[model samples]
Target chain A: MYKIAVDVMSGEKKAEELIKGALKALAEEKELELTLIGEYDIISQELAKTDFDSNRLKIEKADQIITMDESPVKALRKKKNSTVNVGAKLLRKKEVEAFISPGNTGSVMAAGLLKVGRVKGVLRPPIAIQFPAINGSTLILDNGANTNCSPENLEQFALMGQLYAEKVMKIDNPRIALLNIGEEKTKGNKLTKASYELLNNNPKIKNFIGNVEGRDIFSEKVDIIVTDGFVGNIVLKTTEGAASFFLELIKDSFKTNLLSKLAAFILKPYLKKSLDKIDYRQYGGAPLLGVKGLVVISHGSSDSTAIYNAIKAAKKSIEENMVELIKSEFAKNEELE
Target chain B: MYKIAVDVMSGEKKAEELIKGALKALAEEKELELTLIGEYDIISQELAKTDFDSNRLKIEKADQIITMDESPVKALRKKKNSTVNVGAKLLRKKEVEAFISPGNTGSVMAAGLLKVGRVKGVLRPPIAIQFPAINGSTLILDNGANTNCSPENLEQFALMGQLYAEKVMKIDNPRIALLNIGEEKTKGNKLTKASYELLNNNPKIKNFIGNVEGRDIFSEKVDIIVTDGFVGNIVLKTTEGAASFFLELIKDSFKTNLLSKLAAFILKPYLKKSLDKIDYRQYGGAPLLGVKGLVVISHGSSDSTAIYNAIKAAKKSIEENMVELIKSEFAKNEELE
Candidate 1:
């Protein structure tokens, strides 16, 4: 059985909704087993409303909940029984193959680093998120984990991102590209400039496409784009903001008059269907890669459906043996060096 | 009369369209005079098609044209008589109050730095562009000029961006904000964490907001957002790309079925009107701030209308004495230090 730990508390949604998602994920994947960490009474109360297989599911009590605004370090230090901390401990103790959380991103990352630890030869763990593209999805690494990074960190991110894309994402010979201000190899700040040379020279990285601009994130040109967390986070949030801004503008236009409002009503279903490709929920959670164990960080405001998808993402990571692959790959590279 | 030099060559569009824009700017602002630098024959031929004031418009013959793909440094050395070079020379010689170009952005910035030079006490010149906001607009500095920046560079961008927002954008006591991943004062990479203290501690800055995320770029929160050129450029281009991607999706949605097509046809006019606020053409060109002379960098793909609005933007800067204000503000700060 592929055992996973789910942090049922700390997200914006109620624990009941998150439990419903966990149950749904259990129902879909027969070989999957879950240990839901939260207030035992609350989990029991929520699970009482659903029909779940008792053999595949278990409950672990954790009273404290880490909030969105709390400092990651402080929360880690004080909230020993929090859902995120319990989930991390589960992964560290080998009680679960993977851990999933929709709580604070910083907290989850910290817990993953401190409790679960890094893979044997890994330098730093990076959050790799997939952006919906014209064709499928483009994977971008170091989404917000490490704000400042060295060239070696970026090269490692490129390798790990490529492995995730090839194995879990099922892209063949994924084209790896550097996220840069300009497409030219010579056109970047100090970090990207030095990173370009490293990425270009690495024989282990196949199809090392030189550089791509922010606009190319959604384009079908590249499979994986790597950058420091600072730029990646800004690009990710900016794209989200810009998409919402345009959608709002469209809605306002539909309210201009009676005729336009009627037209909007008639076209609502089609618009939603077409726009689903840009929706974040469909892509599931961002995986905190390079850690010793699989850790998936979902959006804080994720609903049951988003949570369900995130669980599926963790299942895929576990099935693919992503952490083992990363460990062995880095071991091979170190031997070669 | 405020004399301005126009680089009639090097943009993606034909020179005739650019000359037409220059002529329109001259017609609208009677006190505005333009020196159009391009091929003499083409300028004369295009001028014959329109009825323009000869006294307000003059042609400076330059046979060479800088292609978009040409290296900026090599182009500057080889194509000495290119339109951008001639325009920069006019600003340097005090023959024009301002210079405008729709050519290669790198070429324009290089010429501005090598030719007109920096303002006294200015460390580096930054490109400041205004993003279309829900209320008015938000000014973001270091758009693409200096990719790598120190904390002091961002502080200066704040001051320069504040001055432009007040003088050119016509806002009263513009609020300056640092673009960061999080809103907290301590939440950022090395550059932003250090820059925040500097911006907050500076007494000359009238209103310094703490921090804004990428999602806040278009929100009606603050006036000026300061960031390193690398992050700023990515945000700018990512915003542009996301907007276009969504618009394309909307268009595709309308073509899904017969009824949806009818609705789209009915809503076209209103959609265009409401979406005009997000249009890049309305914003004109980005100003290269902190330079001793005014240098406005228009988009490479700008058409006649965009070019016309850019000239009007230059006219406003001249009327407000924007360069002089920045000079005096920095000079005063130097004395205080």
Candidate 2:
């Protein structure tokens, strides 16, 4: 069974919501087992409400919860029995193959580093998230993990991102691109311009497309886009803001008069289907790549459906032996160097 | 009369399209006069198709045109008599109070710098564009003007952007914000972290809201968002990409079924009305702030409506003495320092 630990008390949703979702995943994936990390009473109470297979499920006791607003390092230092810390401990003790959290993003990363640790030869564990693209989805990495990144870090992200796309997303010889201001080799700021040369020179990267602008991020041209966490984070948030703003504007328009209201009512179901294609929950969660153990971070506001999908994602990661492949690949590169 | 020089020979659209738009602006604004810079024959031939007041329009001979793809510095050297150069010269010679172009962006900035020059204390002339925000619009600066920016440069941009928002946009005590990954003061990359301190310490800035994340950019929280050209450029293009991508997805859904298609036909006009709020043409063009003369840079894919709006923007910049206000603001700041 693929064992994954879940941080049930740290996200925006309550313990019951997360446990409910974990139970759903446990039911769907017969080969999957989960260790719910939270207050034992809360987990047990929530578990009683749902019909779940007890053989594949276990609950770990935790007294504290790391809040979304708390500082990661400070919270981890103080809240020793926090659900996030407990989940990380479970991974560290080899009790679980992977750990998933929808808690404080920083706390999750900090705990992953302090507890499960980094992959051998990895500089930074960049967050890799799938952005909804015109051609299925494009994987964008370093999504707010490392705000300031070296050219080497970006190249590393590209390397790891390419592997994830090929292994997990099931794309063959994925096209990797450096996200920049322009498509030209010399177009970006200091980091991207230098990183372009690194990606170009690296033989390990089989299909390194030179550069792609922000507009090309969602296009069918490239499979994986590599950027620093700062740029990548901004891109993610800006997209969210723009998409919702447009939808809100459209909704407001539908309320203008009777004719438009009728049209909106008729078109609601159809529009929802189209909009669902861009939904984030379908993609599950962002994988914190370059870590020694598999760590996926879900959005803080993730619903039950999102959490359920995240557990499925963890199962796939474990099944594919993602961490081992990445570890071995980095080691091989080091030997070559 | 407000004299504005127009570069009618460049951009994606034909010279006739630009001339027709300029003529429309001329007809609407009685006090506005234009000096069209282009190939004399092409300008005259295009002008023949449109009925324009002869007294308000004058043609300047330019034997060359600057294509969008040409390098700014190289093209300026080779094509000295290019419409862009001629228009810049017109502004430099004080024959026109403003210059508007939809040609190569770099060439426009180069021409402005080489001919019209910068305001004495200005470090760089940042491109200030009005982004469609939840509450009307938010002015964003350094939209791909300076690729690598120092903290001081960002501070100057915020200052200039604030001035432009107040003087040109007529926003009262505009709320200025530094765009970063997070909302906290310490939650930013090196440049923004330092810029936050600078903006906070500067007593001259009336209302400096610390930092805003990318998601909050389009919201009604702040009036002006200050970012380096690299990030700003990405934000602008990403917004364009996401907006169009969503619209395209919605359009595709409309064709999925005959019933949906009928509903789409009914909703089309209402949706168009709401979407029109986001049309780039309505905001005229991005003003190259901190320059000695007013230089408005329109989108390359501009239509006649866009051109007409750009001319109106140029007229307003002239009427408001935007250049002088910025010049004096910088001069005062420099003196205080």
lDDT of prediction 1:
0.90
> Scoring each candidate complex against the real one, what DockQ results?
0.84, 0.86
Q: Which pairs clash in model 2?
A: none
lDDT of 2 by residue, A219-325 (tens): 99999999999999999999999988998899988998999899888888988899987899888889999887888899998878889999998898898999999
Best by lDDT: 1
For model 2, residues B256-337, the per-residue Cα lDDT tens digits are 8888899889988988899898999999999898888998899998889999999998888888988998889888978987
- lDDT per residue (tens digit) for residues A140-255 in model 1: 99899999999999999999998999999999999999988888889999999999999999999999989998888878899999999998898888887788788888999999
**By summed lDDT, which 10 consecutive residues of candidate 1 chain A come out lowest?**
A239-248
Which regions of candidate 2 deviate over 4 angstroms?
A: none
Candidate 2 local lDDT, residue A113: 82
Worst 10 residues of 2 chain A by lDDT: A43-52
lDDT of 2: 0.90
The digit string of per-residue lDDT tens for model 1 on B44-125 reads 9989987988988889887887788888989988998998888889899999989999999999999999989999988989
